[model samples]
Target: MQITASTVSLTVDDVAASRAFLTTHLGYTVQAAADGFASLTRTDAVDIVLLARGTEVLPPEQRDQHATGLILAFTLDGGLQDQEKRLRDAGVEITMPLREEPWGERLFQITDPNGVIIQFVEWVTPDDV
Candidate 1:
């Protein structure tokens, strides 16, 4: 079986607020919005979706108790600096600041209002060609 495009979706509290934050701050466009549910699309190559709830959203669980440390990461062609600037301009909170590691990857993290962690990274190496 061949898996094509996919998205991680979840209902969120305050659909309008989430919509505004994602669209205005993240450079995402509205793919669909109505009836208390909103779907957004990322402008980049990946078709990432952000879904907001129609009714009251769930409150965040107590940290270290949730037991799930799931995070989404994307390697940007422009690297960490560009994405850091983009996230900053969009008013997203930086959960983890960018720092170089011994693995030759520059990475940073940000969290959405719903607490989804998004890491933007770039690989570093000397280019001979």
Candidate 2:
């Protein structure tokens, strides 16, 4: 099926904590929020949803194990290091520090409090080539 939109609902230990990270660090606009769940829309048209376990949106058993072997990656343009540093300053867990690959793309990695990995990247310019 052609997926118009998809949402990754993560079970968080604290809903407000997850919301703060999603909004402040990841730059998501909140579409809706309640005691048990929060729906968010990324400016880049990405669909992301966060559901608190044992709540209306997701049951305790239905909550993802966070070991689903999945990571939510975002291909971003602009200054990779600056962005990575900014995120790091904002309390995002920089699981992998910013570094340039041998192939020459500047990239960095960070994961939210919920263990969602995000990749921030920038293309190598001619001067770097």
Candidate 3:
């Protein structure tokens, strides 16, 4: 099957809080929203759907599960440092400091209001490795 689009649905304790965090800080626009759900989208990133914990739209077994131990990562083409600084300057707490790995991966992380861990990464050639 050919996939046309991608989306990740996250169940959170507070849908509005996660919605606002993504829209205001992470550049996601609201595609749709309801009392206990929100669909967010971005031109350069994956679409996100936030559902309040216990929302009936989810399967019975998944309704009460909050997104935990999950890290949503986005790989950037460039400007990883500038983006990190921009978020920091905008008052977003850098949950994980930006660092480069020996494998040529540079990354940093931030946790949204609902505790969703979002990580941004950029790859570059590491010298002497």
Highest-scoring model, lDDT = 3
Model 1, which residues run further than 4 Å from truth? Answer: 1-4, 51-68, 126-129
RMSD of 1: 5.4
Over 18-118, each residue of candidate 1 has an lDDT whose tens digit, in order, gives 66766776677888877666677775645444434434343444311321266767887765687787778867788999887776778899876666676
Q: Write the per-residue lDDT of candidate 2 for residues 1-129, one digit (tens) a residue.
A: 798787777766666777888789877888998886778897575777776656644555676443246667776767677887788787777888888776667778877776666777776754545
Model 2 clash pairs are none
Give candidates' CA RMSD values in order. Answer: 5.4, 3.4, 1.1
Give Cα distance to truth, residue 39, candidate 3, Å.
0.4
List TM-score per model, in order. 0.68, 0.74, 0.95
* Model 1 alpha-carbon miss at residue 41, Å: 1.7
Model 3, span 13-125: residue lDDT tens? 99999998899988999999999999999988889999999998799999899999999999999999999999999999999999999889999999999899999999999
Where is model 2 more than 4 Å wrong at Cα? 1-3, 56-61, 103-105, 123-129
Model 3 TM-score on a 0 to 1 scale = 0.95
Show the lowest summed lDDT stretch of 10 residues, model 2. Answer: 59-68
Report the lDDT of model 2 for residue 106: 76
Minimal lDDT window, size 10, model 3: 120-129
Candidate lDDT scores, in order, read 0.66, 0.72, 0.94
